[model samples]
Target: MLEKIFKWILTIVGFALGYAATEIAKNWGFINSIIGTSNIYRIGFISIAIILFGIIFYIVSPFIIKLIFKLTGFLESGIQKIPTNDIILSVLGLIIGLLIANLLITPFARFLAGNTILSIVGSTLTLVVNIVFATLGVNITLKKKDDLYNVFTFLRRFSKDKKSKADSKLGISQPKILDTSVIIDGRILDILKTGFLEGPIMIPSFVLEELRHIADSSDNLKRARGRRGLDILNLMQKELMLPIEVVERDFENIQEVDSKLLKLCQIYNGKIITNDFNLNKVAEVQGVPVLNINELANAVKPIVIPGEEMNIHIIKDGKEAGQGVAYLDDGTMIVVEGGRRHVGEVVDVVVTSVLQTAAGRMIFAKLKSAS
Candidate 1:
């Protein structure tokens, strides 16, 4: 029924177009002279043109309908995926652009009034300017939305009292943005639960999507890690006092998740919370603050001075001969020199030195008797 209605509408439009074309042709001096002022002939020509156009439109309507449906579906899906804030901003931008276009085109419209061709050109120019400006406005607004939001929030707080002044002095605590590796490591939940992390915690939509991809991966290890991340997120949301916000904003132009996280941190003036060493280094290089969980863990571990003694069970051999490897409760590696012979036994060792690397802290030790 809809298809039939659509075909009928197309037929009517085609007939009107044909009649308009005939009228335009009739206005030409040569065609007017050729018709010899015969009204009957003109009527017959218009009737034939209308019938031909109507038949053509009816035959082609199905393909046109299909194309329209495809375009509608594509647009609907795209719009649905866009965040509500972005859509609102884009619409606001479009309105501002149209207003600017109107201001610029009014004078041109008046100047070109006497000439039809020039008037058409002015109208086309107006349309082109409107489209270009609208597109630019939307793109710019979306890209700088976080900054704009911050500005507005500041303005809103400007009228507040002494507490706000103190807050200003203390500096606004920017949200902590979580990355994929941090999520998979799953210690973030505990950190947040401890109230050590201030400000809102944000997980970007892209990061969540990456987690989903990992969770769906065919590799068992990756799948487990991904699932663990998701479970941690769920638990954080359920049991933690701090709200975990899932941010829908994304940098569509950025392909790498780590790069996107850094860009987002710049936008939000936020620190990234992650266990990824490479991400931590890159973010630091780019002047973005990073809260590395591994670094934090290392910092809080028992500080062992050289000559301090502790007992450890040698579970495996180290890369160096006669060096037995043991792990602290916190997963810190302790290398015991001359203790390879004591594998599978617990023995006293004296800490000889401590080495700190980007990865973590390592303790070098010798058997207590040797020390």
Candidate 2:
């Protein structure tokens, strides 16, 4: 039914155009003089030409409209994806551009009133003005997109502060990646409760795999540690309800877990949280910043400087002869010179020096002389 209606419309349009062409030719007189040989031939020729042009236009019209609509939809989607703030600014800029074009070109158009040269120059200027406005609109739109993102970020932060979890606001800051050892040790929960650690806690997929491996290990201790790590991870995800993201990005090229963790840190602009001393050293050598739980524990321990006397009970012999080994409250190893005899005995020692490395800090001391 619709197709029939369309065909009727096209036929009417063709006849109307044919009639108009006949009138135009008669008024112009050139076609009339040539075809005055026969009225029927003149009418037939004009009618056929108009009918052919109308049929051609009608056949191609739907496809042309379809292409136009497709292009418009695509452009609309692309424009929508641009930040809202940018869109608003660009639209405003476009309006300003049209106003400026009108103001500057109107006088030229008036001055060129009757001369063909002036008319050509005026038309060219008008085309340039339109092109300039279009180019400025697109440029402004793209440039303001970043500003739109920043505005949304700020609004989100502001809205977050208005709700509950006011004390937990620190979780919204920079992210900190958690490793298997630190999760298993489980001191981070206590640390987080005190509100010292801020930002999102990221657990990489490889770390989860490591925990799973440990959980499945034949060795009882390793299995227990692995299970414990999994439990801590669940607690963080469910109970403590802290912000956590499991980054699934895996390194097919790197096999080592520590290496993958370092790479993850570099990718996320975050620091790795681990307790492995060797891993800590390796991270330092690779220029990846690490937030070693053990290091943090040591830094917070009581500071003992040179000349400070402390009584330590040495339990074993050190690597060197006549040296005894003791430990601080935070598990920092203290090497006492000339104190092998003091093994298993608590004796006052004077701290002589402190040594710090990527692994940890060490204190070197000598037995205090009896006064």
Clashing pairs in 1: none
TM-score of each: 0.59, 0.46
Q: In candidate 2, which residue ranges exceed 4 Å CA deviation?
A: 1-172, 235-241, 247-270, 275-290
Error of 2 at 51 (Å): 32
Predicted model with the maximum TM-score: 1
lDDT at residue 24 of model 2 (Cα atoms): 73
Candidate 1 C-alpha RMSD relative to the actual structure:
9.7
lDDT of 2 by residue, 65-161 (tens): 5676689899999976764445676776687677777788888888886899889988898879877976776676567755754565456446544
With candidate 1 superimposed using the best TM-score fit, by how many Å does residue 287's alpha carbon deviate from the native?
Answer: 3.0
lDDT, candidate 1, equals: 0.86
lDDT of 2: 0.78
Residue runs of model 1 more than 4 Å from their true location after superposition: 1-172
